[model samples]
Target chain A: MRVLGVDPGLTRCGVGVVEGVPGRPCTLVAYYVVHTDPEDELPLRLLHLDRSLTDLVAEHRPDAVAVERVFSQHNVRTVMGTAQASGIAVLAGARAGLPVQTYTPSEVKAAVTGSGQADKAQMTMMVTRLLRLPEPPRPADAADALALAICHVWRGGTRSKLAAAAERARGGRTR
Target chain B: MRVLGVDPGLTRCGVGVVEGVPGRPCTLVAYYVVHTDPEDELPLRLLHLDRSLTDLVAEHRPDAVAVERVFSQHNVRTVMGTAQASGIAVLAGARAGLPVQTYTPSEVKAAVTGSGQADKAQMTMMVTRLLRLPEPPRPADAADALALAICHVWRGGTRSKLAAAAERARGGRTR
Candidate 1:
């Protein structure tokens, strides 16, 4: 399966794509971060994000998309900005007809580092090891995005099974 | 003086330009909303926004930019999307070499309605009355954007003075 992982932010977004068959390890195909000039108008920044993401999708053509889910935070401004970025990712994936999935920070950590509370450095180290890369990914955001992709690959099947079970439970109740 | 007002959002951004003269009412020069297909990727959306805003700026040549300051709420997804959109607006204004100003929703409402808690309909009516438009501006976001421009025209100087004073106070304390 080919998977694209995203770490969404208002000012910058990290993206990574991996491709692999069912029995083999996924290999990194591409990765980059989209940045908006901090001083630019909000609309223009979003425009840059939109254009860059579309180009990435078209070029990479991943079969599935994975994104980080936004959780509640104390900083209202920060939370708001993160949410906006997440929305863009979702919209992009939906538009491309890719099956989009979301993972929490804890889930990503647990999957990548064998612990739900793995720090950034640990996550980064684990991602490099898992991907069998000669060097770690540059820019912390990009590393986090790669780890998120790994998490999706590891947990995606279980997640689908749980979702199916929940759906069946609801259906049974209705009938 | 000319002011461009922007209401930034994920799918659409509303823009309005007004020319301000000392001791005279601001004149509406142009107004329009830019939109992106939700199905497109983030990069494509950003490109559409960038092209449209660049064109608008080149055509109208506003001297300054006024944008709404987003306040975060419960919806994490929505807030992040808005922030990305806001970033686009900021980048566009900076590219045009315009000094960008931001107004809180309360400030815009207060400037137009003499009440900070004014509803959208109330604010829209006031904006239409102030601009002497034949009808209310189409799209509530557009009207809110115009209100932001008007707010800047009415209170920008005072706000700047307050900001300067606050800066001076910080400088004195540091010394």
Candidate 2:
């Protein structure tokens, strides 16, 4: 399955696309950061993000989209902008009829580095190893997006298997 | 000038359109709430809001859009959704090339009821009186939206005058 992961922000949004399935190494399709001018008005900045994300979804055509769930526990000043950017990312995926999922930072870290409390360096290292890249993805935001995509692919695979098992246990009934 | 006011929420987004200038009673053009199923997924809900808001902007064609500024100081559980909805509202106005302004709840209250700390009941009463409505607008959300619109009109008028004065002070040279 192909997946698009978004690390949302107002000034710089990270986007990564990967292709893979369960129990298989994911292939990096593309990764980039979407940046908006901080000097621009809020509405215009949001509009720019909305358009960029919409274009990314169209260009990638991922089966599913994964976004980093924003929390207020971080910097209070930027949390709102993060949340707003995430909403735009989710909207872009949904508008294209793709399933969108959100994962917490810990969840992505756990999925990528085998520890929920892993530090940024560990996350980057693990992502580099997992994706078989010769070098780590530059900029923490891009690496975080790649990690989220990897997490979704692995977790989504397990979830589908569990659902299939439940279906079989229920005498193959359609649910 | 006409303004479209949005009190952003996920489940029930309130929208109000009003026409007026500073120092005059505003007339309510329309008011309604856009509802999205709470059971729906986050992305779908956001998409629904985006479409609704875009349509509203197109239909109303307001000179400006006024949205309630969402703050994280409110209910933590709903703050993210409110922020997301507010982002969508801002995007709609910006996409249509209309000036969008956000007003705090206190600012709206002060503009409409002459008190920043005015309670909701007072707000509703003043909104009714200011709009010359025979009855109070139902669902506090709608009233809040109208209040925002009224505040934007008055504040925007003042802002323009101040800008003009500043320009005159600068020998009427465009900065």
User: Against the true structure, whose DockQ is highest?
Assistant: 2
Measured against the true two-chain complex, the DockQ scores of the candidates, in the order shown, are 0.18, 0.75
Residues A1-175, candidate 2, lDDT per residue (tens digit)?
Answer: 9899999999999999898987689999999999988877798799889889899899989988999999877788888899899988989888898878899999999888889999999999988898999999988789999999999899964674576588688887321
Most TM-score-accurate candidate = 2
Tell the DockQ for candidate 2.
Answer: 0.75
Docking class of 2: medium
Q: Taking the tens digit of each residue's C-alpha lDDT, what string does model 1 give over B1-175?
A: 7778998886879998887753357788778888888876565575567668778888888877787877775255666557657766766776676667778889889987999999989999988988889999999888988888888877873564566598788883221
How far does residue B42 in candidate 2 sit from its true spot (Å)? 0.3
DockQ of structure 1: 0.18
Model 2 per-residue lDDT tens digits across residues B1-175: 9999999999999999999989999999999899988877798799889898999889989988999998888789889999999998999898898778888999898899999999999999999999999999999899999999999888975674576588789897321
Q: Rate the local accuracy (lDDT) of all candidates.
A: 0.76, 0.89
Candidate 1: misplaced stretches above 4 Å? A1-77, A81-122, A133-142, A148-175, B37-43, B74-77, B157-175
Chain A accuracy as TM-score for every candidate: 0.86, 0.90
